[model samples]
Target: MKIPFSPPYINEAVIQEVNSALESGWITTGPKVKRLEELVCKYTLAPNTLCVNSATSGLMLALKWYGIGEGDEVIIPAYTYAATALAVIHVGATPVMVDVEKDFNIATHEIEKVITKKTKAIIPVDIAGWPCNYSDIYAIINKKKELFIPKHENQEKLGRVLVISDSAHSIGATYKSEYLGKITDITVFSFHAVKNVTTAEGGAVCINLPEPFKNQDEYNYLRCFSLNGQTKDAFTKSKAGDWRYDIIYPGLKMNMPDILAAIGVAQLPEYFEKTLQNRVEIYEYYHTFFKTKSWAILPPYKSDDKTSSCHLYALRIKDISESERDAIIDKISKEGVAVNVHFQPLPMLSLFKEMGFDIDNYPVAYNNYKSEISLPIYPQLTKNELEYIVSTVTNAVESSL
Candidate 1:
C-alpha cells in the first residue's frame, strides 16, 4: 500500500516513442522538436511557441528578450518555486518578492502598489495549475499605461511592463475562455516528468505579443535566439550546400532535442482529453473525500469562467502551526503515504535570506507554507489505490493531532 508522491506516468507508449526516436539518427534538436513547437502553438492558440530544454530556460529567455537586466526590477510572488525568482536573477535583474494571496498564487490587488518606475516586468506564477487572476493584474497594467517607456522616443507606444506568466504548473489550464499560455504576453510551460505531460525534462514558451511582432520574421528571430543566435537552424544547415551561416547575437543554447520532442509529439495527440480527464478524476476524488473535514481547505475547482489543469492536490490544515504541518507529513510517510509541501516561500530559503529578503514581510505566503501539504495526484492511480491514500491521510492527520 505504499504510495509515492508525484510519480511520472510513463508507459509503453512513451517507450515506443523513444524507440522510434533512437532508430532515427537525427535526434538532436531536429524535426521532432519543430513538430512539438507547432503542436504547442495549435493547442494553446498562441501566435508563436518555442520549445526549450526546461521551463527555467524558457523563463530566462523571455526575460532576456524583454531586455530585463541590471537596475531593472521584476515582481513575483514569494510562494512560488525558487526557479521562478532565480530566472529573474539570472537575467541580472532584481526580483521584487511580493506576498501571494491565501490561494497560493499572486496577490493581484497588491501588485499595483509594488510597481515602480524601474519595474520592467511582472511575472505572475500559476501555482499548482491554478491560473492567477490576470484580469485584475491586466487592469492595473492598463491604468499604469503612462508609466511605460516606448522602445524609441517617438515610436508607437509599446507597454514597458511585460506580463510574463510562469505557467510551469498549468499547461491545460484556462483563463477567461482562453488557454493560459495565450492569455499572457509570454507564458512558459513545463513538461517535466511529474507534470501533466512529460517530455522527460522540457518546456515551451508561447508569445501573444501584438502589433510590431505580427510579422513571421519576428517568430523566426525567436527561434534563432534559442539556437545560439545562429542565422539558421541545424535542420536548415543540413540542407544541400547550405552549410554557410552567421551568428546574430550572443544567445544561450537551450534548444529542445528531437529525442525529447519525440515523446512530446507522441504524447500530444493522446494528452488533450485523456491525461487531463484522469487527473480531474483524481482531483474530484480528493475533493469528495475532504469535503466533511473542516481542517481541509480544498484546492479550487474549475469555475464557469476558468479551469485548472489539476496538477497538484494541495490540502491545508486549518489553524495548524508549522510544527503540526511537519508532524502530519511525517505521520503520512510512516503510514506508507508520501506527502510533500508545495513550497517554503523564497524569502525563507537560505540563498534568498542571505540576499536580505525577510520572511516576515510576506505573512500570507508564510501562513500558506505553514499549513500546506501536496498529496499524490496522477493518472495511474486506481480506485483501490486512491481509497488507500485517503484512508492513510485520514489516519495520519488524526494521529498527528
Candidate 2:
C-alpha cells in the first residue's frame, strides 16, 4: 500500500476549467484571475483580494506597498518556512525571529519583547493550517503602538505595526467563527501544488485595513503594482486602441495568469463543504488513532473558537532526539509510507546560521522540529490508506524507541 504525500486534488472539473482558460485566448492576468479574486473575497468575506504569482511574491508586495525597506524590522516566528523570512530580506528589511509556543504559533509575549521603534510589521504564520492567536497579537501591537515609528505615508496612515498573516497553510481556516483572511490587516494564502487548494503556483492577498485606509484603493494600486506598474495589463491592451498606458511605479511582475487562477476558481466552490470537510475527517481519524498512544502528541485542529484547514497532520513523538525522529521517518518510508517534517527552525538553516541566528535560542521551535513527523492528510486519501498510515507510523515509533 503506497501512500504519497499531499497530491493536488485535480479532478475533471479542474481539468475543464483549465481547458476553458486555455481556449479563451486571453491567459495573462485577465477575466479568470479577476474571477478568482472575486471568488476569494466572497469565500473569505474580505473586502478585496489581489492574486499574485506566488505567496512569497504576495508577502513581498505587501511589504513593499507598506514601504517596509532598509533599516526597518519585521517580526516573524522562527519555526516557519524560509519563505517567510526571505520575503522580509527581499525588501531589505531585517526579519526579527521569535520563538513559537507548543501549539506551533508565534508566542505573543516573545513578540512584545522584540517590539522596537523600527518594528514595522508582525508576520504570524498559521503552522499546518492552525490559525494563530490574532487577538493576542493585536493586543501586543496595541500595547506597543507608541514604539512604532512610521517611515512611509502608508505606514503613517496605518498608525502602528502592520499584521501580515503568513496564511500559506490556512485558507478556509476559521478563528472565533470568522475566516482567516479578514483576521489581520493583510493575509496571504498560498495555492502551491501541495496546499489545500492549488493554483499550481499562485497566492491571494486579502486586504482588510481599518477605515481611514480604503481597501479598494489599496487593491487597485496593488493590482497595477503587480504588473510592472503598468496602468493597463496585457488583456486590457488587447482591446481596440487601448494600447496607450503609463507606468505608475517601478513594481514587480507578480500577477497571476488566467490559467492558474482557473484551477482555484473550480476548487473553491467545493472547498468548504467537500474538500475541507474531507481533510478534517482525515485529521480526526489520526487524532482518534493516536490519542490513546502515550508516545504520540497530536497537532491541534479544532476547538471552540478555532477550526483548522487541516493542511498537515504533524504528529510529534514523546522523548525522542532529532536523529531518532529521522530514523523513524526512515522506517516509515521503508514501509512505503511517505512523510515529512513541517520545517527545521530557521536558525538551523545555513542561511540563517550565517546571519547569526542560533537554533539554541529558539528552544520550542527546535523541540517541535526534533520529534515532529508530518503525515499525509489530503482529501483524496481513503479509509484503507488512513489505517495503513497510522499502523505504519505506530510500528515505526515503537521500533525506534
Best by TM-score: 2
Candidate 2: list runs displaced more than 4 Å: none
lDDT of 1 at 233: 84
On a 0 to 100 scale, what is the lDDT of residue 17 in model 2? 96
- Give the C-alpha miss distance for residue 182 in model 1, angstroms: 0.8
Cand. 2 TM to true fold: 0.99
**Cα misplacement distance, residue 92 of candidate 2 (Å):** 0.3
Per-residue lDDT over 22-89 for candidate 2, one digit per residue giving the tens place of the 0 to 100 score: 99997889999999999999999989999999999999999999999999999999999999999999
Lowest summed lDDT window (length 10), candidate 2: 268-277
Taken over the whole model, the C-alpha lDDT of each candidate is 0.86, 0.95
- Give the alpha carbon lDDT tens digit for every residue of 40-125 in model 1: 88888887888999999999988887777888888999999999999999999999988999889999877888888788789999
